[model samples]
Target: MARKKTITKLQILNAAYEVVRTEGFGGFTARNIAKKMKCSTQPIYLEFKNMDDLKNELFEKIKNYLKQEVYSNEHTGDALLDACINYIQFADKEKVLFRALYIENHLGIEKMHKISLDFAMRLMEENEDTKNLSKEDKFELFTKIWIVAQGIASLISSGLLPMNEEDIESNLRDALSDMILGARYSK
Candidate 1:
């Protein structure tokens, strides 16, 4: 008798991640994941208590993926600048995932905001340019840059704006410089 292949929870999660990555959260269902995994939904249900439980775990996984893969670029030696560039690139490259997370709010808006803020603050803490900034100043700077970066990312992801790498980097650099100067002078 041939042994039946057992599907693990990690396998189900990976399948689910691919579904979300390709089709956004709207396609994030057990059936869809099962189709991707070439398995039945029974394995998914057996591994996770419920779809909500799977979704909650998936959300955490997505968050970590974004933090580690999407926003950890160090190309420019400037943490904030690199993060902004990586975010915009991710938005452009992973349009479906970006829309599901930010445009459609599949990820809770407040949680996403907090995650972005926390990540920015951590980068700022490590940056010499922002290392000595007071908490208020840091917040102000982060808000300003985040707004600009988000706007650019939204436009690019929506296909309303077509920008090359140089233009994107230049615009973000200008915005970062302006925000930093404003924060410093306002103190």
Candidate 2:
């Protein structure tokens, strides 16, 4: 009979996530993960079907983390601007993980895109300010906000953008307010 497994799946996944989080997906590999674990990749294989499985699992985790821990529930759909600010803050908290989450694509490249669009759509639906805008217009506007926010987070994470995290954060919040105003008064 095969030797009973010792390491837990959760433990292996945690190690894998840590490896990817610090090293970026390009740097992530079974060999690197094994180095982090101080053991062979056999245990990782045991927990997951293969490298793809592990990669997908990692993406799922980072994706869910972004949705929940980042912007899971906004109490005041009225606070659309505040919600946008909070979204950026979540990225700030988990910048590396966030970047990896947004880029990972075991299924295909567009999968990350769909996930981002879905999140933006949900936020648009919640914000009363954006509620009246046409779907396409609303998506376009929020996509801008999402891109700017992610770029800001990435820049800050990489030390390329330097500013008070708080002060610059307000810029995102204000951008949402401006969008609300634009939507409120259209040509």
Candidate 3:
């Protein structure tokens, strides 16, 4: 009979996620995860076909983390702007992981862009002002806000700028207002 597994697949994935969280994808390896898990790499290979499979799982976990944890910040009336702040805060906090996912392109640009777009759409749906916007306008305004947020995130994550909450709020508020007004005029 086949032996029952000891280390769970989730445990392995979690270990890998932690590694990537602290060290980025460059440190992703069986040996690294094994060190983190305090176990042999055998369980890792047994659970996943290869590093790519493990990475794919990690990516999904990251997505869920973003939705359920990062974006679930305390509501402050302006849910859309709060969501942008949450995203930038996440980047500031998880610099290595953010750099890996966004800057290093280790997670693939297309997937990240789609995920960001989807998250923005969900936030828009929750906002009273944006909830009724047409798809084109929503996409246009969201794209603009996302661009600004991403720039701020990238700068903060890369240490180009300090993680100043006031600065983030100011930049995002100005951009959000300008984008909304521009959309109104163009409409």
Number of the top-ranking candidate, with lDDT as the measure: 1
For model 3, the stretches where C-alpha displacement exceeds 4 angstroms are none
TM-score of each: 0.94, 0.79, 0.93
Candidate 1 backbone overlaps, count: 0
The TM-score-based order of candidates, best leading, equals 1, 3, 2
Model 2, residue 24: C-alpha shift (Å)? 1.3
* Residue lDDT tens for model 1, 66-175: 89998997878788999999999999999998999888898798888787899999988898778789998899888898899999999999999999999999999998
TM-score of 1: 0.94
lDDT of 3 by residue, 29-145 (tens): 999999999999999999999999998999999889888898778646677888889989999888888888888998899998888789888878887767778889999988899
lDDT of 2 at 134: 86
Q: Write the number of the candidate with greater TM-score, choosing between 1 and 3.
A: 1
Please give the RMSD of candidate 1 to the true structure.
Answer: 1.9
Expressed as tens digits, the lDDT of each residue in 55-102 for candidate 2 is: 788778767765676666554444445455556565566666556665
Q: Who wins the TM-score comparison?
A: 1
Checking candidate 2 for backbone clashes, the offending pairs are none
